[model samples]
Target: MIAAKRILRKAQRQLACRKRKIAIEEIMESKGDPTTFYKLVRQQRSSTSMGTEFLTLNGKTAESIEEVTQTWAQYFQQLATPTAESTYDDLHLGKIQDDINLINQICNSSHQDDIPTITKDEIHTAIYKLNNSKAADIFGITAEHFKLAGPSLITALHCVYNRFIKNQKIPESIKRGILTPIYKKGAPDNPGNYRGITVTPVILKTFEHIIRQRHQIILEETQSRLQTGFTKGTSPLVSARPTYRVHNRI
Candidate 1:
């Protein structure tokens, strides 16, 4: 019995060594690709605290992987679907009403003819601005696909964009995105503890970049100087500077 236990322990040690070697090789191979490298690192960890397993909802326990997935889908769907009882009666009004009116007036008075049409050059520029190593949308399309596409594809996109602009309508496909639930905190089994991150199509993002680029001047002029969050080349830490000074004075 003692001899048998010794042999089993030796076998387990050998298996662990093999796994360690394999993991090292994979990490080395993925060194150049930051996305894959981080993913591999995550896999090497013993366990994750964020439980994606929908063990139970209400009183019913999920029996299979499919059931768990379905439960998550239903939970997110219900959250997205607005209640029939919902109304704008709970909202409050102040000077915001005047601001809304001003925006509406500007939009109504804007001339469609004065707006410049989408061009191939603009499409190329937008495509170039896309970031690398992002999650694909529902269609399995990534930013890399657009970045590597030739001039012919750029011309095609240019035409499609202009057509949408001329008709004042966007295709339904462009608006679709895939939502991934990321665990935040609290009970892992509870869907309420997770927030969603939507993966939008690269093409749709490129089009948005084009629109933003066209209105860059206006946005820069109208944007508040004190705002730091989400603004390019500005850090959220900048907003903390004033708070830090106030704390020191106090």
Candidate 2:
């Protein structure tokens, strides 16, 4: 019995040594590339916290992986789908005749000439601006991949965007998103504790960036001076500075 226990302890020690060697090798490789280091760290953190094994559904615990996945699907479906009894009442304002007229005038105004076609420079700018460490969408393409791709790839993407703009339609691939549920501050077992964050394709984001550029011009022309948030070169701090000065004067 003593001999057998000694052999088991020796095997356990050998296994632990092997694991430590592998971990050391990974760390050494990651040190050469900061991006790889960040990715490895993120994966390690996600593996520990993100698990579907302990999910609760309909007052019962899911036993299998498939059951847990299905439960999450059902939960999201129910949350997205509106109940038959759900209704919205028409909103009425008693004294907003001029406000309504101004809104109608702005909505009816034509601004076709302001819209610009997608250009290679814009695509390149957008690609470089994309975050490298973000999770990829369902297509398994990351922004870092695009950033490394040569100018030819940017040109190709520009052409694709122009084609999409000409058709006045976005492809289904662009519209598709992967929903990842992130746990908030609550019980781990409860589905309500999690919030779904949609990860969109990097290519779609490039197109959005081009569109935003055109929209920004129109917004600058039409948007009220009081509205500073989400505009270029203006933030909440910039908007609050004038208000702070006024308050101090009073």
Q: Against the true structure, whose TM-score is highest?
A: 1
Candidate 2 structure quality by residue, lDDT tens digits, 1-250: 9999989866764564455345435645776786775464445335453354457878988747688778888999999995645353324342465688887787467353444677788888778878777677678888888988899898899789887766656888688887766554355567897767677888898788777777787898999988877777878787687899999999
What TM-score, to 2 decimals, does candidate 1 have? 0.66
lDDT of 1: 0.74
Model 1 lDDT tens row, 219-249: 6889999878888889889989898999999
> Model-by-model lDDT, in order?
0.74, 0.71
Stretches of candidate 1 above 4 Å error?
Answer: 1-51, 58-60, 84-89, 92-111, 224-229, 235-250
